[model samples]
Target: MRVLVVEDHAFFLLGLVTALTGHGHEVVTAGEPYQAEKLLGERRPDVAVVDIKLPPTHSDEGLRLAALLRSHEVPVLVLSQYAVPEYAISLLGADPRGRGYLLKERVAGVAQFMGALDRVAAGGTVIDTELAAMVTRAAARRAVLSPLSERELEILALVTEGLTDRGIAERLVISVHTVVTHVQSVFRKLDLPKTPADNRRVLAALAYLRNG
Candidate 1:
């Protein structure tokens, strides 16, 4: 796989490039958004790993670039030191396919980062679980979130982590029936629309994260 990395921090960039190369991926490096844009025009990569902040403006240049590239069917995985909910919402927009938002700390694990890159590159969403919890907590005051019990909130967080019903049950040491009940409650309380063709669990989580 070919990947374009856009990050201004030298140390992080070096480590990321090394890790990706070691994992058998071809890497193209750029230090800033402009250079990244130039590279994008010149060569199309399988995926773009971008930092949420960049040089010159250092304020959402990576996100702007991600949004721009997505229009052309480019997959992007954005990393940030902090999980800015607004940026996550905007980067994801309506189409969550081929996009991901991860905390910078997650990059420390080469396997984890590579797995996320592979998923996003294949048109899947991979949001950081901690970030999803952060967004959920911030919106705790909202009425839509108020109806959910603490157990329901826990289940919702697991759902956002891309856990299956059985997975959530195993993690929580509960029955699959219990997990199903909580999931149903979460959807009902959150007023998540029913869409059989879509990944409604993820959509519900995104909606809560965005609105909250």
Candidate 2:
């Protein structure tokens, strides 16, 4: 797999490049803001792993860049220093496929990090369980996620991990039909409207993570 890494920190960038290359992936790198754009124009990578902090107004530059890349239908996996639910909401926007938002600390878990990158590149949505816990807590505080049953919440968490219906069913040792029933119940309880893109699962999970 080919990956483009956009990170300003040299040490961390080197670590990422080294780790990804060692994982048998072709890695392209850019250390400066906007350099990723140039590389994107030059070569198409399966996925772009970006850091949320960058030079020249080090605030949300990477987030902005991720959004831009999504507009071109590119897959993006964003790494953030904090588990900010709002940031995840903003990054995912309407279309949640081919997107991911994970905590920067998770980079230490090489297997987990690589799995997330592969999932996003394959057109799946993956948010860190830690980040999702943060959002779930926030939503609970606001009483926005109270309507979901314990089982529904469990399924939502799995969905947030980018599991498909069959995967979720297998994980829970339940039938696919049961998983679908629970999923539909979740959407109804959340009042998530269906869209032509068939992204209701992502939308419902996003709503839970975003606190309604």
Give the per-residue lDDT digits (tens) of candidate 2, residues 12-46. 99999998998999999987657888888887888
C-alpha lDDT of candidate 1 relative to the true structure: 0.81
True-vs-predicted CA distance for residue 149, candidate 2, Å:
2.1
Candidate 1 C-alpha lDDT tens digits along 38-127: 998898999999999998899999899998889768899999988666777788888777888899989887787888788789887777
Candidate 1: pairs in clash: none
Task: Report, for all candidates in order, the number of backbone clashes.
Answer: 0, 0
After TM-score superposition, the amount by which residue 58's alpha carbon in candidate 2 deviates from its true location, in angstroms, is: 1.1
lDDT of all predictions? 0.81, 0.81
Off by over 4 Å in 1: 141-143, 162-182, 196-203, 209-212
TM-score of every prediction relative to native: 0.84, 0.87
Candidate 2 lDDT at 180 equals 83
